[model samples]
Target: MTERDFDEIAALALKHTGIVLGRHKANMVYGRIARRLRQTGYRNFADYLEYLKDNFRDESTNFINLITTNLTSFYRESHHFDFLRDTVIPELKKKSDKKVRIWSSGCSIGQEAYTIAFTLAEAHMASAFDVKILATDLDSNVVSTGAEGVYPADSLMSVPDDAVEKFFEKNRTGNQVRVKKSIRDLVHFKRLNLLEGWPMKGKFDVIFCRNVVIYFNRETQKTLFNRYADYLPVGGYLIIGHSESLNGLTDRFKSLGNTIYQKIY
Candidate 1:
């Protein structure tokens, strides 16, 4: 693809999703979009670019999905879940009503959200707690896959045997495992562009936005973190990727170790 074409698409992505692909990302863009070009029988990036400019609604959506990264898995950053089960939930139980609202922002493939559901079910027992997990992603493809709640057996390797037996069913046709309806029902999945205005209502007790903001520019990161603080109640938890830090970002939250932050009232 030409540099101009790269710039155009990158700008459109940034404008729509707050993801900044630097000049060095041109090759990355080429690699990701090239396959789409071939699959659609377009001769080159230029043709694909023209198609995008024409703004066929479905094509545009696919183009955006092509560029967004959706690498995620269940129990990723296990320590965060440990913290949730040990520290965060215990604190929330005291302050919250029976209903606990958690947002898995940038949730990919539903694993993170499902992990939360599983944790809550195990902790509360009998599914008596009014727990709700809202999982959202910028990529519609990943969101759809997450809503399906099926996975390869290998993906469940880290999950405990008892939990697996309780939460998944083996597909006779294949080696896949489908998440039990009870667990799937605990999560609500939606396509959400974080850079856009949020349509969600109500403050959350916890927001897990792991490994997502590393791709955004510093200004975007600051804005996103502030918005997370806004959506959280006082003493609410914000858990980010282990590699991420709020250093030099904002002072709205107090560091609580383990990459966790608490919003001060």
Candidate 2:
């Protein structure tokens, strides 16, 4: 792709998704766009760009899904789940409402959300307390997949055998497993653009926006962080990715180490 071509595509991505696609991502972007070209029956980048501009109303979703990265796995960041089990749940148990809400913002394909469900199930929360996990992503494709709650059998390699048996049922092919109804019921998957307005009416007890802000600029990060703060009450939790930090961005939260932050003000 020419420099001009990459610039236009990057600009369009930023406009729609608030994701920064620096020149360094040119090759990766080119590859994904090529897949789009093949799917859309376009002959070249320039032609695809022209078609995209005219058909944006119909194609913008595909463009955004192509540009956005969705890299996630069950217990991908195990420590976060550990903290949820060891700290967050116990704290919630003490509350009188007996209701718990956790959001997996930018949740790719529901692994993280399902992992939270597994933790809750292990703790007997399904029968003892009211629980809900909202798993949302910008990619509608992944959102649908998450709602199906089926995954490759090998994806559970990191999970212990007993837990896997308890949480998922092996399909006839044995190559895939579907999350058990009891576990899948805890999560609700939807397509959401973080840059757009959120429709959720209630504050989440914990928000897992892991690895999502790394694609946004500092200014966007600042806006998004404060927006998250607005959705959380004081002492509510915000858990981010391993590589992200809130320092110099916002002071609404106090770092509790391990990339966990508690809303303090």
Candidate 3:
């Protein structure tokens, strides 16, 4: 693909999703989107670009899905779940009205959300408080998969053994597992673009965004973190990816280490 063609596609992605595609991704973009060209009967990137202008309203959805990376696994960042179980949820129950809210902002396929729910269940908060976990992702496809709550059996490797035994049922082949009703009932999945406005009404006790902002520009990161702070009350928790830190990004949260932060002000 030519630089001009790559630039146009990148610009569209950034404008619509707030995700920046560096020049280095040009080859990767071409490789992934080439199938769309074949399906649409376009012979080249230039033709595809021209075609997308008129059809982007519909095609952009698919394009965004193809471009946005959805790399997640059950408790991929195990420490965050440990903190939730060991510390956060207990503290939240101590202060709240016997109801707690947690958001998995870039929830991807719901592992994090389910993990959070299972952690709370293990903590026995279900005995006292009603817990709600909202799992959201920009890609609707993954959102639907998360809602379905079925995954490859191997996906449970990182899940604590007790959780797997309690929360999932193996399918006939035992090659797939589906989340049980009790755990599934705790989470609600929705399609949300972080760059856009959020529709959630109540503030959350904890927000797990994790690894989502690495694709966004610094300015967008600042704006998004500020927005996250707005959704959290004083002392509410925010857990981002291990590689991410809020040090110079925003003063909205103070570091609790291990990429965890607390809304201090």
Model 1 lDDT per residue over 95-212, tens place: 5467788999999899999999888888873265677899999899989989999899889988889988888999997689999998899899999989888998899989999999
Q: What is the lDDT of residue 80 in candidate 2?
A: 93
Candidate 1, residue 56: how far the Cα is off, in Å: 5.7
- The top-ranked prediction according to TM-score is 2
Please report, as a residue range, the 10-residue window in candidate 1 with the lowest summed lDDT: 122-131
Taken over the whole model, the C-alpha lDDT of each candidate is 0.88, 0.93, 0.89
Whole-model lDDT, model 2? 0.93
Give the TM-score of each candidate. Answer: 0.94, 0.98, 0.96
Candidate 2: residue pairs that collide: none
Off by over 4 Å in 1: none
Tens-digit lDDT string for candidate 2 (89-124): 999889799989999999998898999999989988
Clashing pairs in 3: none
Root-mean-square deviation (CA) per prediction? 1.6, 0.8, 1.2
Minimal lDDT window, size 10, model 3: 89-98
